[model samples]
Target: MINKYNNSNKDVKYLYKNFLNIGQVGLLDKFDFSEDKIVQAKKCTLYTESGREILDLTSGFGTQNLGYNNDKIISERIAFANNNELPFSRLFFNEDVAKLAKKISSMLPGSLQYSFFSNSGAEANEGALKLAFKYHNGQRKLLIHNKDSFHGKLIATSQITNSPEVYFDFQSSLETDCIDLSNTDLLEEKVLKNKDNIYAIIIEPFSASLARPIDFKTLLKIQEICNREDIVLIFDEVYSGFFRTSNLFYFMNESDLLPDIVTYSKSFGGGISSVSGYTTKEKVFTKAYGSQKDALLHSSTYSNYVEESRVALKALSIFSNTNFQEEINQKRKYFIKKIHEITNLKYVESLTGDGFHWGIGFEKIKLLNLDKLLKLLPLEITKDPRFAEKLYVSSIINELYRKYNILSYAGFNSEIKLFISPPIIISEQEIDHAVESIIKTVEKKPLVLMTSFVQNYLLRFLNKN
Candidate 1:
């Protein structure tokens, strides 16, 4: 096999060059991997080309629930590859796929037994939306999503997602509206107003970007509303599934609060296989694509291949172990407490989150607030309120990687918030190390922190070079 990385700056340049040629350069800029490129990883620690050991907190956006380079997953992949079974057609009956589906069904709540496999979380959500739309006989055209919620980037899914500016080009022309999660009154108002034309209400169950988990009572209320109006409800567990939130799923453990359709991926494949799936009740499946004539209506070419299926089956087994779940809960409490303790720092505004996920927001120092100082001079900086805070968090993240080898990121589109979502397997020692790193990284001198202003200039120079 050809090598993807050569442990050199040339390789990094080639990766960035092609990445900027087609993809969003802003994403690359948000992450400062300029010092070295990662060549291997084990659990929560990343091994870089320059022999630096970096602790991963993002878990590749929460996909590595079991952490990286899992031995069992790797052995399974090798076994599957050695068996010469791959890229097989899903048209034929595959025992491994059926078994995996059955395993997943046993763990899901209520009558969510029927399954549809796909390649990614986006594809699973796309299939879920289609299922909901077809279940209602294409009669309901409107969908509701909570503000700052992320579902996927597919055309229909993107329409229901909260960030219109990011995925607007992929949006559907259909009617869709967003409701604020902070106000249940407004949420209910929107649901009632659009009750007649609504096909579904898709949500992340827990807002990944905001690091907020919806209370069980609120979820029950939403479920009741959807049921009363005959609207399909979808829980997008792409980032929260497979014990990331100290639960197999945030919506699990409650029989009455189950959604009509549940979409999952990310950690479900144990960071080994790119697999995703959607599950619903038999009634909904029958209404949508259960007919013999609609057998192949929503299937994908890579849907239920044997390799991904076997890997998912193993992943489910590992995640469902009771002992593992208990340990994860303990880790969650420790992690959250440590993060909250950091709020005592002068610059930290607040720590908002639950379980193993969190967002650390910073306060602008009055003395060093460049914008405020400029206003004193009868001049002004950018009007964005979070500009200074964003720069501060970005600088902290950069320093965290450079000084302590702990990976972190600014919250999605939010300047002051730093996202912390380490793998479930992360230990107490690692958590303590992360907390110390964050404190030391953020508690820098004002003049030293101001150097983050060079990011724009550095980006422009890199793009030109």
Candidate 2:
């Protein structure tokens, strides 16, 4: 086989050059072309140039629950595609879509039986919001979202998202009435006072911004309030779904509370291109878009993309299997124990998360050098809010690439939290390596040695060049 990173390959060189020119490197811009480029992936690992192996901890932003290039899912998709299946069958029903919908609905708890397929997480959230408004006849106008929750990037989802920077350019179109996620009392008051005017109240079961897990009791209470006031409760489980949080669904495992509408996406496709449908009670669907004319109210051209749906169907099967859940729980317990043991690190103020998703909050860490790293990153990567924290993580990633070649992203912004959601197929040894890398990075005072050692290295590199 030809070399993976052969500079002679004009296609690869052209792509890399274009990436450097137009990429909007954001968040701590640390990743660059000079680094190893991954050309193939398998299980929980990526294969880069020079045969370097990088363990994936972020799981492509938590979409690869089962891990990269799952063999079974790939086989299923290939089988579907080999049959010359049409991807877009407008207004026509396909068996794979029906079967996938049935499988997803079967896995969910309660009367969440209806499924509306979409191509992305944002589309799923948008569908959910539209469903909520249609169900309540648009009389209920306000939708409540948590302060640090990330829904999606569509116009509606962007509005509900609490990040000022993400929605900075789209201020005019963003929603104006989202409440602070922590203040439950205010949420209750708003729901009670605006029952007639409120369409739905959406929340991330696990708060991504604070890296805090919502209390089960609080979630239950929110459900109770929504129920009492006839407001629709929507759980944006795009990030916390499909065993990422130690359960089949975060809402199902975290609490007994049920929401009127629940949206899922990430990890559903098993790292494939597919998105997912939102589940809701039969009544909600009937009340919202009961007629044929209303069917088009929330449909996507890629709603039933054949290959993506096939992968999703297989992925759902993998997650629903009992053995996978048992294995994941065992691994989760061990991982949490190891994190707790690293209590002496000064930067680690607290560690919080459940299932496969978790975060580490840093107290104080100067981030100038981290900023320099960010300036070097490519632009396709989303800008994280926790810049300092991300910079620290990028440093660790860079070191790992230099030595062990492990690659992972710093989730959120500069808040000192490293978002981790390794693939379900990750080995114990891989987890140990990740933990060791993180602990070593946190304990070592790289910033302190910057003036003497780090600066000298930079100066030497500049002189040599």
Candidate 3:
């Protein structure tokens, strides 16, 4: 067990603090057992250096849909190594690339036949935006996005993102506008008012970041408007695609409406390869990059590599071959029933479910009587009313991991949201364990929770100094 990474002479935590991101260190290095070091992962479980098993509920932020180090997915990597295939040369004639693109196209409904490969979700979305502009020959000057969503951190994608925390303040290259999805009437008016300048509308079918769900009627209205006005509709499914949200693609299961383009990543790589792509209809692709002169205009050096495509092909196979509707339906029902039982717990405020994605809101601080403790905490987090609730939720997240072996985290929801995004491969037994643990954790008085959170931070600070 004394490997190079786990060597006694080398301190990984020190390296992370000095060389890597210190903030990121807390993601794995907290809870009551802060000394425990996770050295191995398999099938939704993380093993510490001392052999402690921690059930992973975050799914590595939804990238591990099939669980960690999945055997079937690793087989693809082994096959490629034995064959000594082209890992990367920017070659245009690889069979796996064509096969992957075709496989992705076939799984989706309608005329989404063309694909532009990339290395991340942001790149794919950026490409989709570019395609929209080219499709209109620069005649369109505006893009519409939702204020409750996030697309990516890249320049163009960041502009479209509306979340206050992550959204940047700089001006955008394109004229961007926002709409409130809750009001369908205002949504229609916004689009009609800017019909001439509008080129595309991008939205997340399911806002996995915050466990937000879209109404079927609103979706249809947007589809109708886009179709009538010849505007492009793009679905940013980076976090919710590839059966992570209980569907092959979230939009397809909800309704028969088809989007002009769909950007995908995260689970598409099967927790192995880092591959992403945006799929669109043949007509859109032809209008944007059909000519031989423009076909390779937007290509990336690392866009279509053999190894990534092979692994992605196997990942897609696992997703497509399995019949998940029955499994998702049964598991979701069991989880919902359990959540309903815990709705009246002492600290539990609101509980909502959407497939495997869920949100558990905590009661505000004023009701919790944490005024004294709130004054003692750092000014940065305590000053904002919005962030105060976040700290309250963080306490629950900490206790959830400290007392129980389960891991949960705060979502990007505007309110005090404790998001539980478990892996799709989770079992009935695992679900029972997680639900029971949550109930026990919430039953504790909020005052006790806040006290523990303060102590945890104090401990971290002392150790750092």
- Top candidate on lDDT is 3
Model 1 clashing residue pairs (backbone):
none
Stretches off by above 4 angstroms in model 3 are: 1-4, 7-10, 23-35, 323-329
lDDT of 3 by residue, 246-288 (tens): 5777788765779999999988888988989999999999998
Model 3 Cα displacement at 414 (Å)? 1.9
Candidate 1 per-residue C-alpha lDDT over 198-229 given as tens digits, one digit per residue, 9 for 90 to 100: 89888887777777788778888888888888
User: How well does candidate 2 match the true structure in TM-score terms?
Assistant: 0.88
Please give the range of 10 consecutive residues that has the lowest summed lDDT in model 3.
1-10
Candidate 1: deviation at residue 121, Å?
1.4
Off-target runs (Cα >4 Å) in candidate 2 are 1-29, 32-34, 164-176, 366-390, 448-465
How displaced is residue 419 in candidate 2, in Å?
1.8
lDDT of 2: 0.72
Instruction: Summarize candidate 2's per-residue lDDT along 1-465 as a digit string, tens digits.
Output: 135555643355456557764343322223432344577888888876656777887788888888888888888878877888777677676888889889988888888898887878888888888898889887766777877677877777777777644656555453347777567798877766765787778898876555567878889888887888887899988878887776777778644778898888888887875677788999999888889888778776677776688788888888888888788878888877776765668767778887666777666555655556445444444274444445455555555555556666555532446666688677778888888877776676656422332343345445645
For model 1, what is the alpha-carbon lDDT of residue 34?
A: 55
Predictions in order: lDDT: 0.78, 0.72, 0.80
Clashes counted in candidate 2 amount to 20
* Candidate 1 Cα misplacement greater than 4 A, ranges: 1-4, 18-32, 164-171, 253-255, 364-385, 414-416, 445-447, 452-465
What CA root-mean-square deviation does each model show from the true structure? 3.9, 4.1, 2.3
